[model samples]
Target: MTELAPDAGFRGNEKLKGALLQHAALSPAGLSERLFGLLFSGLVYAQIWEDPEVDMQAMDLSEGHRIVTIGSGGCNMLAYLSRRPASIDVVDLNPNHIALNRLKLAAFRHLPDHASVRRLLGEQAVRTNARMYDRHIAPNLDAATRRHWEARGVTGRRRISVFNRNIYRTGLLGRFITIGHLIARSHGVRLEELAETRSLREQRMFFDSRVAPLFDKPLIRWLTRRKSSLFGLGIPPQQYDELASLASDGTIAPVLRHRLEKLCCHFLLRDNYFAWQAFLRRYPKAEEGVLPTYLQEQHYHAIRETTDRVTVHHANFTELLARKPAGSVDRYVLLDAQDWMNERQLNDLWTEITRTASEGARVIFRTAAEDSILNGKLAPDLLDQWHYQAERSHALNTQDRSAIYGGFHIYEKRPA
Candidate 1:
């Protein structure tokens, strides 16, 4: 695990509150924001929703390039290692995310082989995973990270035991998916049946017959109208508003329905692990379903060899970038964080990003709506320094297998 400052968890919580508490505490929006902050302070994403393959292609990563990214579940950062980047500085305001990133790095560096790593992370509920952690991964973790895993949860079992019972099914996002499953079941639909899809045609057919009508239900529509309903998705109050704006009826259900359709229909089920996680609640067997790039056997050796290059920090992205030297970073992956930022925060972040960016540095981010968030929000002087790859962004957005986000953007620094 990478070194951490004293009181890192407390500091991370404070930073998260600062970013999320944008409205007055007494107001409905404020209460929603605070509630989200509380839930987000703990584990959220067991697996990041962004498609790292599309991210890698957008960033055009090359050997020795220095990269900076917001670590969610840490999957993408590990995937990035396959390109042999010189260094990766991962920043996140969520302490759990920081711990998760470090734990993953330790797993890659300390675990005996790819199979053990896969069994621990890729599969669901294996009793041997706790033993594997205790025997191999635990001894290698830093004190802070070790304590995070060893600490008991409400179940009186150590947090690390989640690996023994489906880690992906435990987080806020995981629980949200569980709720979605229950709701679908109540309506007489089995979402997991989509996994049996053999082709895109069958996938679309399954979605249309089994999933599409659920959105039209009076209950789902009403639930989506409330901002609090999406808190399980790690979507804050501000982001909820943006997502709601995307719907023609000014309701969130339609927007969600469209994204879900893409997830179910845009790619082959065998090829999209995101779909596997969504419908099956766990990745399928190696031969039956696709896995993230980092977990694949072909890249395991390379990722493990490069694990030492990653440094995990529990801090705000803008603040971390401010501490770095100018023109030092070659790639930036924002991962939908800008949706939570106010105008001032947006400007502050872009200032540091522009200052730290190397020549031709490429920056990628996602938005809740189908357009770049920077157009009117960021200062012209700052925004003008980068060239938006509108055509490429649209193309890559379509290729993103996660299919949850409305837009995927790529911006390249212009010549001085």
Candidate 2:
């Protein structure tokens, strides 16, 4: 598997706090921690979770703003490109992520048209992906990224061959969904049938009849309690603790059930691409408007036209910020990455952010719990410079298409 064990975009603060940020791949807290660490160290997310629509709306990007964002799966960076930002800088510590971002950039720059791009990433089972890569995308890629796609994965096949199969269905989240499907089938539940619902009533009935009981299963309950089973979902140990603490009685199962209800019930299956991927493991074909915003046909030309505006870095966000002139950046998208940080690390990150944020800069992030995490950990003097839009945050939380997170916060820099 492609290991990202050290690729988390972490700024190693002194005191080894950044090292503490990622649970050790070899020496975890326990057996569960080790396994979870191993899973996290791989291509954990072939896609990012935080909704880019929500982020874009929060950032108010246009032609002049500069954005420095965490490039999880590189989806959001492409999404940002669609908005015509002056420039976008994407950073990740994960070599796998950096490679993925580079591959995506190469695809946009080289592909002949929209359909070929769609076939390679959207429908899968393309005959010409490797040929296209060799003649077009591959030649444009940097050596490290080209090497990553050419390297063999578990199937004794180069990872790029997954484009000939299903790329979305190949990563850690993909495997996790596959496992959930197997577990559901063992209990006579057909998860895919949930997609057939015609309306909200049908969706709720299907969940009540066919889906809710799966949550109560003794095996699932046991796994959810184990903590490591969550590794596939990209829930690190620290975030898992915050999730457990937010529960009414400090149990994770009910909390998950509530979130799943929002995912499966609150949104229509026809348009909710996240739900489509969760239950079906692949996005809707090109005709459906359910592909990621960056992949959708309407946005294709705009995203491609602006691909040069984005630059990917295999470095920490702080590293990028340190090099920028003071107040050069206009917006930030943290994406619950800070939930992994400790006080000293948080302080260190904010110190740089405070120094580098442009006037009226806005920062957006999500957390595992319903409350903002910066309250106690951040120094009041530093924290006081930004206004936490609590009311707006609560409203946005309800709108986040990804129902996995508990809180969505928007903090704008107070006028200088």
Candidate 3:
């Protein structure tokens, strides 16, 4: 039978077990990091690194396409809805992600207008969010998702009350930013200075002067050595190795430096929301880039109108695809998850994909390496059914505003 899908189950402990370690390459520290990463994935991802603009450009979605994607933060999936696809199915192994996706879907369905959506998701600190959830959003969610948010913490406060504060600053990414700020403070560097840079020249200068030096410090280097320290970045150990392999300087630090440069310099601070949340730990003012596409005022109504076409599943992609009829799905957004799978797992995935995918179906994914993961690993017999769009993939990888991932790949199904 197919290898038991990685982290596939509804039982809480089983889910956690699956989530904890998808890789075999961990040292003791790596194991700790994997555990931390698993726990981190169980909360809201105030931001996901994939660029939906680049994603939509790659998919070029039409009314005829049926889309499936991993609902990491539920951000890109909602962003996908703006295109008015026939249907989109978003799946994730993390129940928290499924919950987040459902909550977003529910918010789109129940919120009165664009301003309400923005205030709740963007500003994210309104005291009335809990009340709004009570009145408009909570009832619409399934029991599991509802219970997940309503569950109490040690303070006896319902976890849903997180929205009453800056919810963007609550999850693993939030804590990571806070810790980064703390580290920067100890080094006499204000992490916020990146936000004040006026242009690419200024940003590069500021980075060279202020940010780049932080990497060379003893404490920063010490912490960076422990893979657990990066769990906050949503980086798993497998992907960590892939990224580490890319460093021309033989350290992960340079790879990070290049990525930071891309995040800060390649895109203007006024427009890149990912950089805003990263450097400033919150989104910019509404007049600026402000928010993700799904949360933007211009796209709100379109997403709201089409939100009903979306559904969230707490399952592995291969498992989800296995149940679908042949030639049913037209688009797949794999995110960077295959980095977590083994060669057999990858082949198992393509086995189902080759079966279920419609003619001309497009599958897109990102990787921690600039080169492809599937090129040498995936079984050639299964791979031959699809054509890799290398030039477009490389071009799109450059255009990707996220700038975090090293590769963006696209594959199209061949004529049978």
Candidate 4:
């Protein structure tokens, strides 16, 4: 994992206070702190670092459609950008995630070139990359964001700060996985070894024998009981309730086992670069391409250029949707954002989503529970107006990068 610089000044700050409050509510059972110490032992940036469901066949970008996405780690946004949409707006409540998105954007725009950009973010080597950021990238940051990134750390170079500090809680589900890795490492088995597999069978074997067995241990199982611990993995408290229901007595291992199986056994480990990043390097796919996209180098520039039309917002999905004009967006990628909301929040989010629907606009999101969030929670009047692409959901989930998410739902707004 890239070591983020230490934030010695974090104590007594509002950000720390907010994180504390969030951790308290998210981990009400009091197990999160211990699990957190065992796992992260530092700043956590929980993120779903995988791509959102991308359906190239159904999407005709030249038809001109605006898109809104939850933008966990902005991977989906970059992938979506490859389709050449009219515009894409990405929102996230986590400031760190927002900053991470900006950093990604900066890398795309200002790095010495594509190769260097890849080296900086992919390999995570920061010496020369720090020079690149200090000379070019830092000047482009918005004031508040600049301060956020510039907060001094052990590394005098601000870019190195991301590596020097603990950045586990910034995205969707990454933080929890980071926590898991830390904890599992403390127990002796290196989760990073799962990345050493040369074949799909080896990957499967490593997961079953070396990796999954660690979770079966008594202490790890006990740690899984905490909402905060799960939150670190980007499992919101509300979703944890549903996941608990999946087992007879609401045990977490079964749910975790199911998720891990999907991640390891369901796909080719060599092609699943997201898994390689999570379990091995603790970074995104490098410039040379890692797994799935390694062979698709032709799409790289198209992907890079798509960055221009995308704007990252440091706000919740509901808040972002609320500001959008009616019928202005054609695609929505809400990656398990509903898992974190209450019914009221869910209603508001869908209401704005429905209000913003353009003709044949497609909205995609994931859920912790097998069921879609729209069932009874969304009023029938609005739900009925939109078409659920259940078949498409199944197909995409099968193809999803990490395969850890439960339900991948797609909704299409009827023509006005």
Candidate 5:
């Protein structure tokens, strides 16, 4: 919010297009890229999929460390405040994401108490949220961010009204989950029941009995074959290719099934909020289950006190990094953005990362496939400056509760 210049809405959309539109206008892949860009230009993730707890562990975050990260849904960035970082520089190509990060920071600074914050962001659908936004949150927001919330959505409601409804069910990812639920219901499967499972055994039983079979359905299988069908999951054309290649049969169903299994069975539903979003379409009640770190009560005061340390920029990661002084940042959270990059973009990003990274800096990111995207893609000279913690990455990847990404990677800068 601090560095976002005026007309960011236009500039961010163009930047998003440049990042996503990798092919020509006439080809099938090009068309899919265009379509994805259009949808991605709007609000995509209502809740970020990467598990911030895993991220914190991988980065070994310490007090007073400077961090740079992609601002998706804004939860993880705020959650990082709990570690007492000296500062956090958040960059994103989506204006909606920029507005959202700013809004969340303002909510922390202005909202009266923890319950007020929770009701607005956690219990997102309460009617009082709109009133709360107008009374407490709105006045504190920067003009660009305030305008973003006041803008009307396709439903002809001010975007802020999404809180009055189910905010989690309104974004592109939210709509995607809704469609998944509808499809499952059409087959007479209730995904919500997975949330009620008492044990991992019960979770596996639910998946084996109610969920896994859907992947084998002809309609479901065919739909998975289409790259566009996954745009809601924020999978772009290049990433779709990476994910499809992971399956021995050259299809995405198996990969989807594998990730969904991890989400359903590997983690307890009582603890994983990502599963709650996927199945229940909203976070559980405080008395019922867990919430993201930023939304939890214990972290509220810490985050609010440190809200001033965050700066949201409507810009590309590499571009933002290029502006920073050498050896300045201690941690980097890419959050799967490299999966969208080509060879040149990857190199440009790493060049800046290596240039800007502090001694012993750690970088964490996720990928759609079960390997670091940097292997063979990033230039050897730039890549050699960093040491890949393959063993630790594999260990942490398993601990990520979100379970959507195929791999979690950590790279530490070698002593210069």
Candidate 6:
């Protein structure tokens, strides 16, 4: 893809920015202060924090079809690329994310070698990363994206400076982690001592007694239940409204509890090298200035090759599906995005999905609520052609890397 110039006529619109967040029910002060850091800073949900360890047992990725996904932080997109699909199209509404994905792709493709690539990205802790970006990464960046990274923080300081400090307290999830630490402190349980706890049972007991009680508190519940409060986690007001619709009384404590439980209790915390990056390292693994794989040597080459066929876009799912040729994509990774869509958007997405699906295509997505997104809402005509493995989805979900999701579903496209 060819590079494009930054918009010369573009001007900051203060009024529009205010109203957009307000319309999303976020306060102007909160938007400018707390939410700004989450959006602008590299404080992402760490989408790849836990390898999904997507089970290749039931699905055959070598079938060689195109793939479409929401490129939240680009980790999963890159992870899926390891499977060697014919092509991958990644779309996201957030331009920051788009730019970030582009940066990763460029680094992976042009960096001296895998080791250097790992040093710059995987380690992410090298003191000269900003220098490397200025030298290698930034020069290659498109004008707009270059400006985006350059405009961040102080001059001569690269964007990676956020990691040198308390980056964990930066994003939505970061704020939550901060809150968790505070709560842990309040209960006289220091989170820094997690390693001291020798057994899983001890970890569970400590979490249940100390952290879990925070969710049950009326004040925490009141604050977190609001849409604006969750902006840190990048949950827009629209998705919050849908989440309200899913619950009986719109109380979010249970949902929050479940996610927090997974974060604290699941093999996720133990096996996830990404989580280790957050709680353990302020930055990702960077060798000299390259990024290393979370996996061992065996999976590295396979994963890197997947990068060849991957393409990231700044588009909506429904629109992308509408334009796709019939029976094109093999796997769909929609990460809890449907909770933000309306019935029409849902229908449009699935319509094209069923129309374009090859036989036995597997579609995976998560939901904000425990209920399946497609349970009864989808039209039977379109629904009949797909198989919903509720039992299997439930079973497979136990293996999901990030336990934060409410539901993990797989829809197998039936014969046309």
Model 3 global lDDT (CA atoms, 0 to 1): 0.80
3 or 6, which is superior by TM-score?
3
Model 2 misplaced regions, further than 4 Å: 1-35, 248-250, 286-289
Q: Which candidate is the best by lDDT?
A: 1
Report, for every candidate in turn, its global Cα lDDT versus the true structure. Answer: 0.90, 0.80, 0.80, 0.63, 0.89, 0.61
Tens-digit lDDT track of model 1 for 1-416: 23443234433566788888888988987888878887787789989999999999999887889999999999999999999999999988877887888889999999899999999889986889999999998998988889888888677998889999898987899999999999999999999888777889999899998899999998899899888888999888888988878777756998999999999998988899999999999998967988889899999999999998999887788988989999999999999999999999999999999999999999999999898899799999999999999999999999999999999999999999
Q: lDDT tens string, model 2, 1-416?
A: 12342333233212223324354445555444445545655576787888898898888877889899998888899988888888898877666677888888888889999887777767767877877777889878777778788887576987888788787886788898899999999999988998678898898998889888888888888888867788788787888998989666535888788888888888787777888888888887645438888888888998899999888875676667888889899999888878878787788888889899999999999998889999898999999999999998998888877788899999999997
Candidate 5 stretches greater than 4 Å from native: 1-12
How high is the lDDT of residue 72 in model 3? 85
For model 4, residues 178-285, the per-residue Cα lDDT tens digits are: 666788888788887775677778878888887778867888778777666565564545577778877775468878887777777766666566676567645444
> 38-140, model 5: which lDDT tens digit per residue?
7887789878899999999998887889999999899999899998899999999888888888888888899999998888889855888988899998888
What TM-score does candidate 2 reach? 0.92
RMSD of each: 1.9, 3.5, 3.3, 5.5, 1.8, 5.2
Clashing pairs in 5: 1-312
What is the Cα-based lDDT of residue 174 in candidate 6? 65
Over the full model, what C-alpha lDDT does candidate 1 score relative to the true structure? 0.90
Quote the positional error of residue 234 for candidate 4 in Å: 2.0
Question: What value of lDDT does candidate 5 attain over all alpha carbons?
Answer: 0.89
TM-score of 1: 0.97
lDDT of 6 by residue, 1-416 (tens): 33322211112322213222332326554344334433433435544443345534334456376778887667766666566668889976555567667767766665555665555555544565566566666677666777766665546665556433443345556666676567656756566554444456876885777667777677667766676666656565555665666556556666767766665567534454543443444342322112323233355566666666777765667667788888887877777777655566677778988887877898887776667788677778888888987888787777765566666787898876
Ranking by TM-score: 1, 5, 3, 2, 4, 6
Q: State in Å the error of residue 383, model 1.
A: 0.9
Give lDDT tens digits, candidate 3, residues 1-416: 22222222333435334544554546674466457655654563766779999999998887768998988888898898888899998877676666777887899889898888877788755899889888999888767778888888799998778888887787777888888889889889987888777887887788889888888888876666656677788877777779878765546877777787788778788878888887888788876555789888888888999988987776788878998999899999999989877787899989999998998999999998888789899998988999999999999988887798889999999999
Runs of candidate 6 exceeding 4 Å displacement: 1-51, 55-59, 154-169, 183-189, 238-250, 274-297
Error of 4 at 333 (Å): 1.1
